[model samples]
Target: MNDNLAVLRGYFDAMKAGGPPAAMPFYAEDVVLEVPGAHPAAGIYRGHAGVGEFGATMARLTGGTFRLVPEDLLAGEEHVVTVATASANGVSWRRLILSTVRDGKLATVRFFEGDQALVDQVLSA
Candidate 1:
């Protein structure tokens, strides 16, 4: 695999193994994470601390049940698109992650859910 793809794969592997804290090392110092929805965790998270809060908030809101299982990764020169299943509290939905890598680090990530309302309902509960 290419370096960028490898980097993303490593990040995802870290996440799967140990959650956000384990994945933090793959993120750039000024990384930005954009999460879409009307739920509490839906917002733009900047830097390591913000990303940590985002993960913590989601975990808290979901009672630590939220999980992501990656199914595919498509890479380009500047970005990688990840297709995954996101689940919490027995509800599951397809999630698309658009990620950008800069200088071998994850610089930005924007999440797109297949069913926004379903995700909102699950998290809001």
Candidate 2:
């Protein structure tokens, strides 16, 4: 496994162990995070500050039930794609986050939600 892949693993492991704060160390200072859909948590988050804001926004949107559970991790030359499920209440939605890494830190993350309807319902509820 490469360093980027290892970082991806560590990110997920940390997320599982704790929460978003645990994974923030793996992100670059100028990291960009894109959360999809037309909900409260759907926006463009930038930098380490954005990481904390994004988590806080998600918590509020999901009423503190939102959780990311990674099911797969794929690594390329400069990217690591994590297939994770975002669950809230009894609804679970899958998403693919393509993370671009630079200097052992995640530079960007683009999220693709598998179940947009479910995501909408959960976040809009």
lDDT of each: 0.92, 0.87
Q: Which ten residues in a row have the lowest lDDT in candidate 2?
A: 15-24
lDDT of 2 by residue, 25-97 (tens): 9899999999888787888999999889988887887778877878889999988999988788778878899
Off by over 4 Å in 2: none
lDDT of 1 by residue, 15-57 (tens): 8788778989999999999999998899999999999999899
**Collision count for each candidate, in order:** 0, 0
Query: What's the TM-score of every candidate structure?
Result: 0.96, 0.93
Off by over 4 Å in 1: none
Best by TM-score: 1
